[model samples]
Structures are given as structure tokens and as C-alpha cells.
Target: MITELKNIKKSFGSTDVLKGIDLTIEDGEFVAIVGPSGCGKTTLLKILAGFERPTSGELLMDDALMNRVPPEQRNISLVFQSFALWPHMKVKEQVAFPLKHHRFVSEAFKKQPDVRVEEMLSAMSMSHLADRYPHELSGGQKQRVAIARALSPAPALILMDEPLSSLDAKLRIELRYEIQKIHRQFKKAIVYVTHDQGEALAMADKIVVMNAGKIEQIGTPQEIYYYPETPFVADFVGKANLLEGTWDNDQFSPALSPNVSWHFPKVSTSFKQAGLCPLRPEQLKPTADNQHGIEVEIQNVQFQGREMIYTALANETQLTIVSDADTRIQIGERLLVGT
Candidate 1:
């Protein structure tokens, strides 16, 4: 492991921000920490960047303790949401700043700062705007410069706090590919904190879901989406419609329609104990057969280019379902919905 956070907890007065966070980042791994607002994702990122000390527990970097280490002393780089570039410095100067000032800068970089800066600018495709100031560059360019600067020092780890949150939708998508390219080229471990689940799902190798100051689940994107261990993970990550249900072995009978039983052998025990069954939006299908499904009323419909999204009600419970564009169901229409 390159970095390890063991039982990490943090609080400000009576408000506990992070409660017993334990995570490990392997070398060159892209780990995304995602959660709703005030879920301590940023706080956890700050702790990793050494901006805040943990209340208790150990932080290890390369097997050495880093709990009380200063941000400047640690071999870590941070890229913030606001694109914290120096307004006075040009692009080249911003990329060169770390090599000139960082204590952990290698001898090769220190001896040839100009060459290193050029290479970083080229890597981020910012060489064309080398002399441009922050005011002269677009938002995406400024972010690219910031990323180049972060990578210039060749830090052991990089901590990014919503780096693409300020960009437009198109620019965000473009930068996602850019970031992933550099990650592959440089092989640096990243601890990314973001509120956008789509970004986390698209870019991260591993996803950490958090809620109410605790980690809900940690797994690969497929695992987190396909097999959520908690109701919160199911609802938050995959937007799975959780149905109140009772379990009998591998079969589940939803409370709304006791006659309907679903056989799912792989559900987590926590969900079974809570008497809940999570069904994804695509899993619920509208069927003409009335005997083998739950009765629901279509409340709303949204037509995308390829698919239609539906808001439905069954026994006072609201559910979301997705279907192909060709399957049109008018609002307020009664239908039988089944898996």
C-alpha cells in the first residue's frame, strides 16, 4: 500500500465530521470518495493532504506515520475545485513553482526545472499557453495548468477536491479523459473527492461511498452499482428503488403486494434484516399481465433520446422506472409493473 488511513476520526467541537474512516490506496490507484454534502468527503481529503489532523488513529505513508506532518513536508499535491492558480504567474511559472519550492523535489528536476516544466506543460497540452496569465486563460485551461503543476513534482500521492466541479458540462467530460490519460502516463496514486456520482463512476477504479460521516461501502464501480451492501449505497450510488419487503430464504415478498415474491440469493444480510429489496430502474418493467406483478399508477414521464424515465406510485410508495423510448405509457395510466 502507498497510503493507509486507520480508524481515522475527526471532529470540530461537538460536530463529528469523519467517524472511523479506514482506507488504503495502492500505488497508481485512482480512488474516488463520493457522498452527499456534509458527508465529510472534503474533510477526509483535507486530512489526507495534511491540512487537518485527525482526532485519533494512525495515518501511514510508506509505512511511516504522517498524522502530525505538515502539508509542505508531505510528498503530496492538492488540486482544489476553484483552480487555485496564481493570478500573477504565467502558465510556465505555475508549473515550475513546485520544483523550485517543494522540499521533496528530486535532484534531476531541481537541476533542470525548465525542462521539467516544459514536459509537464506538454503532458497537459498547456504548452501553447505557456506565457499566458490566469486571467488570459479559460477555465479549462486554468484547471489544466493546475493539474500540470500538481504533476510536475512527481508526488507519491495526489489529492483532488472536486477538480472538475467548476467547469461546464462539456469541459468536464473532456477533462475527465485528460485526467485519466495523465494518470495512466504518470502512474501516480490519486485520492479524488467529488459529489458527482457520474464522474466517480466513469473515472475511478475504486469507489468509496459515504453518508452521515461514515463509509457506506467501498468497491469497484461495478460492485458498488450492481451489488450494494447497504440500502444507503443502493439508493445513493445506483439510485435503486428500495421496496419494503419480507424475506423467506432467497425469496422476497414486497409489502405492497404480498402475493409477489422475488428470488434473489445474493442480497446482503443487512438488506434482508431490514426487510428491504432494491430494484434498479431498468429492472422494473411494465407488463400487461396483471396476476404476476405490482399494481402501479404512472405519475410522470420523461422522454430522453434513447430511453424514457418514469415516476410511478404503488400503494403510496413512489418508484422510478426506465424503459426504452418506444414503450410509451401515458401519465395517470394504471399498469402492472414487474421485474
Candidate 2:
């Protein structure tokens, strides 16, 4: 199923939450909406799920206008951050609820909801907790049951709003893989909303970065990480060092450190004359020989498990470098830093 959102705008009491969002989700694509709190990622997802109507613009599902469609009639399932499981219902009962409510069961299985429930639970590795209540299950198990329920109706699309936010780090990682597995198994279009950039980078086929109710950039993870179109996206989507500078003669000279200049491999005359130059931490490296490198003083060193993060100062400019942990570097030492 293809879903297109054209010039979507939403406002409440003069506060605009979504500003002219135009996005499309192809069949079985995993798209992630990522941004900081109040950036309107969730608001955009609600528009697609039919929970909230846009103030203007169109929502089309496979060429059919869906702006006025109710959430229940949208053929979409939403998995919220809070699990939203029935406290009194057992695991199997919770999974079967949607099937019974929507009459999704076939004629052969109309009388046996347990058959479908068991199949879903087993697929999610939650069959052992079938008879357990929400209170009796772990956080991860409850989330799995919630997913099972959302998939029970076999909806054409799935919307997940930070579904793994409540779990611990390890459980969150584990469930992320499970969610991807389920998405592949169901072959349904998914729009996942999260504030975590790592989650979006690790799971999504396409990542949409939003800032202040506007879409800053939308692309594959590699493009978003390495070729961000805007300053907001470059800084928000990954660890980037933004150097404000003026472009002149195929070189970018940092305004703060006028003596430091970086040569652009391919300078485009049409590019902005004054803008921020983005460099990832991993892009900078240490050089013992200062012949042609930017001289910088090591301010601090942090030894991570697999790599070392060195904070250095180039005149007044602070730079972060990720290097091998085995590299011998000390605080107060002077070294040449380069790309």
C-alpha cells in the first residue's frame, strides 16, 4: 500500500505543530520519523493514523482520500509507548481482542480465536505467557503482546509511537530486532516515530528528520548521516562538529579561527557562501607529523571500550576526534589533527 501526505499542516490555538509536511511511504517500507520532543513527529504520525485531522492538506492511501476517515476505519494499527494492554485480560485474550472486534477471523476459525491468538503469540515468542495477565508479564512480554494485538487485524499499515521507550537499554535493543522481524513477516508499511537517532539509524529504510514542525531532511540512513542537506539535520541526526565559516577560493576558513582553513574537494559556486561545515568525530584523525595538518592541543581524552574520544582545541575552536583506543595520547599534549 502507498500512503502520501501532501502539504500537511496542523495547528492548535495558534500553535502550529506540523508545517507543510509532504511525505510518501511506499509499499512495505520502514520509515522512521525522528526528532526532539515537540518537533511534531508524533503529530505527523497521528495524521497518518487518522487519530488527528490536519488543519490543511491531503492524506491519500492508495489514491483514496483518508482525511475524514476515523481511526478505526483506516485499516491501520497503532502501537503506543505505553503498551496499552487490558489489565484484566490474559495475554491470549488481549491478542484475540482485535480479531474478534474487527471480525478478521476466517469462517473456519470464527469459533476459535485461540487458534489465531496462539499463532501470533508463538510468532512473537510469547506463547509461554498466553494465560498470564498484564501484571504478571515482564515489560518486554507486555510489549510483544501489544504488538500481537496490533497485528491481529492484519492492517495495511502499522504506526508505532516510541513503542520501546519504556524498556531498559538491552530490552530495547532486543525488541527493535523483533519489531523488524514482525514488519518483514507482515509485509506492511510502517511509520515508526522515535526521538532516538540510533533507533532510526539502525532500523529504518528511510529516515525523516524534523525540527520545529518542519522536515529538515529525508533520506536513507547513510545519506542522512553523511550528506545532511541542512545544518539542523547534520547536527541532530548524528555526532557532527559544525564549523561556521566563509567559503572563498575553494577553501572554508573558520570564522572563529581565521588561521584554520579546510580545502573542499569539489567546491560548487552555487553553494551558500557562508554556512556551517559539518565534520563527524570519526572524520578527524591524529597525526604525529604537523607538516600539513591542523595543529591542535589535546584538552581531554576518554577511553571508550572500542575507541578513544579526544577533545582538542585548535586556537579557540574545540574539536572532537574518535580514534583507536591503543593510540597513545595524553592531556595537554600537542598534536596535528586532520581529516
TM-score of 1: 0.96
lDDT of 2 by residue, 1-339 (tens): 899999999999899999999999998999999999999998899889888999999999999999998887777888999999999999988998888766334554457777878888987999988999999989999899999998877778889999999999999999999998988887888899998899999999999999999998899999899877776787798878877777777677666555666776543333335466787898878765444367788899899888999898888888888988788689999877766
Candidate 2 global TM-score: 0.92
Cα lDDT, all candidates: 0.93, 0.85
Query: Could you tell me which residue pairs clash in candidate 1?
Result: none
Q: List the residue pairs that clash in candidate 2.
A: none
lDDT of 1 by residue, 104-211 (tens): 899999999999999999999989999999999999999999999999999989999999999999999999999999999999999999989889999999999999
Model 1 stretches astray by more than 4 angstroms: 289-291
Q: Over 4 Å off in model 2, which ranges?
A: 103-112, 246-272, 288-292
Tell me how far the alpha carbon of residue 26 in candidate 2 is from the true structure, in angstroms, after superposition: 1.0
